[model samples]
Structure formats: C-alpha cells, structure tokens
Target: MNAKELHDKTPDQLREELSNLKKESFNLRFQQATGQLENPAQIKIARRAAARVKTVLNQKAAAAAATE
Candidate 1:
C-alpha cells in the first residue's frame, strides 16, 4: 500500500490495516526463522506499509489537532 492510498482511508481503517500488516510481518518473521519463507522481501514490504499507515495516521492526527 502507498502513502496516498493510506491517506485516503479513515483513521479506523488505517488502524485495521496497520494491525493486519503487523500480523503479516510477524508471520513472515516466523517463516524466515524456520527457513520456509518463499519471499523474504515481503517482510520488508509489510514493514514499510505499516510505517506508511502510521505516518498517515500521525499526519491525520496532527491535522485534526491543528484544526481544533
């Protein structure tokens, strides 16, 4: 997922996405530890996606604070 896409989602949606990404990241790490991971790159992708969602969520929170 991209930052732009994440920015378009509501905070609740972003939180859900972040949670899912984290779960996937954890699973990927487990797979890697067991040496059964097919694509190790996915771990990095999921991490970055979670970060993007977080960034967007922070931005939204900041914007809301500013408006208030």
Candidate 2:
C-alpha cells in the first residue's frame, strides 16, 4: 500500500488497515518461528506497511490539530 492511497482514506479506515497489517505481521513472525515461512522478507514488508499507515495517521492527526 502506498502512502498516497493511505492518505486518501479517513482515519477510521486507516485504523482498520493498520490493525490488519499488524495481524499479518504477527502471523508472518509466527510462521518464521515455526520454519514454515517461504519468504522471510514478508515480515519486513508487513512491518514497513504498518509503519506507513501509522505515519499517515499521525500526519492526519497533526493536520487536524493545526486546523483547530
């Protein structure tokens, strides 16, 4: 997911996306721990996606606060 796409979503949608990303990250870690993971790169990808979502959320919050 790109930051531009995330920026288009409302905060509520972004939160849900973040939740899903975190869950995926957890599952990826579990798979890696079990030696069942085909690609360890997935773990890093999920983490970065979650961070992107978080960054967008923070930017939205800051923009809202600035306007108030």
Candidate 3:
C-alpha cells in the first residue's frame, strides 16, 4: 500500500505481496484483451503497487548491504 506499511513488512512478506500483485496484473491484462475488463484503471494501479513493493525491497537490500 504505502511505503511505511511496506517498510514494516519482512522481505518475505513483501515478496509475497509482489507476487500477488503480478498475478492480479496478469489477470487484468487477460480480461482487457478479451474485452471483459470492468476497470481499465486496475491495470495501472496494480503496476504501481508492484513498483512500490519493488522499491521498498531494493531499499531494504541496499540498507542491509550497507550495514554489512
């Protein structure tokens, strides 16, 4: 959801969330292709959510590397 929320989650949880988002995105694309999509905006939302999770994950990795 938000950066603060994502930052509070463990890496494993973040990965799970990212995986779910990707699945949702794929489903949305399929629906769109078949002209059955209810909301086209959902595709964009899912993409941005995935990107946010990725950004937080990268930040955590970078911080861990710095500490090491």
Residue lDDT tens for model 1, 1-68: 77778878999999999999999999999999999999989999999988888899999999999999
Residue 49 of model 2 has an lDDT of: 96
> How far in Å is the alpha carbon of 49 misplaced in model 3?
0.2
Question: What lDDT score goes with residue 41 in model 2?
Answer: 91
Which window of ten consecutive residues has the lowest lDDT sum in model 3? 1-10
What tens digits encode model 2's per-residue C-alpha lDDT throughout 1-68? 89989999999999999999999999999999999999999999999999999999999999999999
- CA RMSD, predictions in order: 0.6, 0.4, 0.4
- Model 3 C-alpha lDDT per residue in residues 9-66, reported as the tens digit of each score: 9999999999999999999999999999999999999999999999999999999999
What would you estimate as the lDDT of candidate 1?
0.92
Candidate that would win on lDDT: 3
**lDDT ranking, high to low:** 3, 2, 1
lDDT of 3 at 2: 89
